[model samples]
Target: MTDQTDGGRRLSTQEAARVLGVKPATVYAYVSRGQLTSRRDPAGRGSSFDAAEVADLARRSRREAAAPAGGELSVRTALTLIEPDRYYLRGVDAVALASRYRYEEVAEWLWTGKLAPGAVFTAPPEALAAAGRAVAALPEHSGPIDRLRVAVAAAAVADPLRFDLSEEAVLGSARCLIPTLVGALPEKAAPSWPGDGRISRRLWSRLTAREPDPDALAVLDLALSLLVDHDLAASTLAVRVAASARAHPYAAVSAGLGALEGPLHGAAGRLAHRMLREVLEQGSAAPVVAEYLRAGRRVPGLGHRLYRAEDPRATALFARLEELPHAAPALTAAREVATTMARQRDLHPNVDLALAVLTVSSDMPPESGETIFAISRTAGWIAHALEEYQAPPLRMRPTGHYEGPTPPQPLP
Candidate 1:
């Protein structure tokens, strides 16, 4: 017995092959591929393998073979890398960037690969007017995302050079497009604070009728920064597909906005908001949370597929909110929900729960979080679009395997 074989006895090649249900050659192949670790005996015996690694790999292999499409297939991306519990944007710590930098800064970094301190984000007045008109033309019950889609379309029509897919031209278009989208949404009042012209404050005005608190404004900015890009999210993938076809930046972002409307993606924030509101109104989380569990319903904002530990983005935002007095109640409710879910199912809250808490605690509209998600994700979409434009056209097409009924005869 050795102390290093996952705290148990190591196995020789023959024994390991037996446990793995494979021949000795297969065991050596596993070692060659780095799937199993093997150590040589000090007394000149043959290589010994870690039993636990062999067992784990056997289980994983079976599960993967039985799984359907989209099972841990690696897609090469230089934009973002998602690790066990945290994500990096172009090799930068996203959580660190969110905490210290504004959304504008993060966007610049993602789109241009540099965070210029003196960089400016400005929208053309004519485009802003066009966005306003487009938003006003929508139905009264339309959500912010609907307005965003209309605004992008309008911007596309207004910009004659929108077809220029060059990087320089695309960067200019994206910078104008983001603020214009924010400006197009309904705002209760004009910028009242000193730096109210900033997109975060402008967006804050549009999201709520209340006076903008500095702390809340900071949280909103951080939220935007945190969400700017998340590898290849559903929305980002949609944007990339469009861009691969040489679609304009506006059209690419529109594709992303369309995917963002799906419930399992960007719109998850609204569902989470509803659940948290119920908890806040009832004065306790147990009853409402328990009812969802008993009914076999998925508890929104409770779990994430990519993160095994606490979501770093959620943690960063919650830590910021802890310093703000006004966010206490909402934070408390979020904690209760988190604790309850972990106790019951051992699941952790993801970025959605953090977003819900931000909106509810700060008294933003129910749809505010989704709006933030769309706007922030716009930066990511554009980054992906830029990347895709340089790739071979139509390279993402997958060949379909025919599983339908066989033909009776050949064109009789």
Candidate 2:
């Protein structure tokens, strides 16, 4: 039940309790509140998630993932989303919001749970340093998301206050790490957080040296808002598991960060990027898609686990990109490729694919896109962590097989 969860370590309910310094029953509360994620094993029993992501969530929320409550603690849950579910930001669908608002405004809506009618951004020391580290650590050939994975992992290690889960530090990491990572990914020199203003409280603020074009910023904000939450992403589940253990926010956030490093979570963006590139190069989506179907592999960046409507974020970005002046040939080419999918195929654009083109067009640094996502997503993770912190820990236990005990009674 140790707190650290790296390289895909999953924890059960009882195990989670040991890490959080609480009983297993409290962990159950976390599950009921949508703070934790789990899966159904073959036996129809649900298994809890890894604790690392929960700890990571704690770090950004300015609170522990799970704290004392009525003499009980949260517990791990065993549930699954057979399909992806629709996500929202500030009560708006991602696509509609992106189309109508600026990135700054959108971020505010997500963080505050209100559509604050103003710009949104953040620029904290941690955000700045972490963003740079993400880009610097990338292999020369890596894409935005891959670099982000490495950067996030490294940032967790580099934080001077890695174990401090105070409100100041957690909020500080949310503001600083996000913007800095966005700025540094483009191979730029070190970035300094803006001294004052609302932007100072934002993760996206410092990522751009100049004032963001209102339109582009709006789109990004919308995208960020949309991506701010999901039912129980693998990494997010990790966040709740840590809360079940009563790990501090930073520790839970570290766990979440580790989960994001896995291919299933953080790497989805890279898949979208690669798929778009392939489609553009082929100059025909049909053959490219056909090939995948032949191999019986599902297409990336096409259908989603949730959302009967095309991903609103994707639609907004694609529509907006279409409107941009003299959009680059690569972007135009990518859109042509995306359109080839059937509308009824229920195939739609997702945030990842749209971001691939948007980041390139923004001329942001190589890994800036993925780094930004980590920064942006921290907000949602933090929110979930805070919710977890209010609950008590839970306990979990299961029977162990003893078939061989009698036969192996001889002492060594």
Candidate 3:
């Protein structure tokens, strides 16, 4: 039962329990745990919950229940910590670090505790040549990620010292492998000169034909720095698992790249890019957002489970994008999408949305954001692999809970 109250519709305890897919006792427990709020009934009935609040709680409950059992394993790490609205890298504010340093400097800091102010990563001639040949052999219809996977594999094969898991050796491989991956991509822009060794500049040439303004390049570099690590994301976990099995750094990174190909992970930004483009062509976000909802598709890049407020990475990127004249239209469209969605639910823009604005305004293809994520996250994957190398081999193996029928009777 529900009552239309001055504040909103109020669901009785029974109704709340039914909505939450739990018993009445669990509903009371939720109120006590502060997961839900309840108010005393006016006519001396039992507690009542706000209808919208119960619905939101129910949604979260369904999502949590859908996740695989025993999937929430926790491991101690000194890398990154995600809070409600902000995240940190080794106890330092990530946004502040990105704002103050280049991507190479930040990556160096993440790898070693020491900061290298003018750090630069350069690909070796042999490894770069091998990766380039491998990437060039792929079909013309292959995507950026396909090229990246092939490049990493070829780079691994080219490195004679790839099996040396010592800290110094692994770091050496990382420094070379990162640049090799960037250098392997076929350049979309005309080669004007021997480029500065900055990873962002080289990656920019591969992403679009248009020359980048200084601010645009700065934003791209910042995006790279900000994305360096996010504390045991799915791909990072994959890297760790591979590393736990004593896989070499290159193989560990390959594991991460494989996991990143999933749509729910690295490909999110591409979806957001397409949606923003649609909003631009349609002249408003309403119709585009409405069509998405009508078709039972999520309006991507709006919410993140780790954040209740704005995603800090998104906030930082959006701030930088506002100063770029070319980004104004895409930025406005992003804001419109967020605002329109906000009217229904309090979802905020995530980093993917900000990345979409960058990709859309810069005349890059939809897959550019994923490529950036893959390249930037290589640093983090290598860091995790290095950490895992120090732990006991095969430490990530977990016992599975068996739920099969009686084995003896199934022999037929």
TM-score of each: 0.80, 0.60, 0.82
Best by lDDT: 3
What is the alpha-carbon RMSD of candidate 2 to the true structure? Answer: 13.0
Query: 2 or 3, which is superior by lDDT?
Result: 3
Expressed as tens digits, the lDDT of each residue in 1-412 for candidate 1 is: 3335445777888888777655576688678878899888887778887778778877765454345358443344678888988888889888987787889888888887788674567888888899889999899999988999999999898888899988899999999999999989988666666474677887887888778778888989999999998888888888888986789999999999999888788778888888889998999889989998899988888777788887888999889889888778888988898898887587888888899988988787789889999989998899898877754455455456798779775775
Q: Please list the C-alpha lDDT of all candidates, in the order they appear.
A: 0.83, 0.57, 0.91
Give the lowest summed-lDDT range of ten residues in model 2: 74-83
- Give the Cα error of residue 147 in candidate 1, in Å: 0.8
TM-score order of candidates, top first: 3, 1, 2
| 1-412: candidate 3 lDDT, tens digit per residue | 7899889999999888777755576688678879999998768987889999999987765554344356776665778999998998889999999999999999998898779988889899999999999999999999988999999999999999999988899999999999999999999977576556789988999999988877998999999999999998999999999998999999999999999999889889999999999999999999999999999999999999999988999999999999999999999999999999999898999999999999999999999999999999999999888877754456576667889885767555
Q: Which stretches of candidate 1 lie over 4 Å from their true place?
A: 1-74, 194-196, 408-412
Best by TM-score: 3
Error of 3 at 267 (Å): 1.3
Q: Residue 135 CA error for candidate 1 (Å)?
A: 0.9
- How good is model 2 by TM-score? 0.60
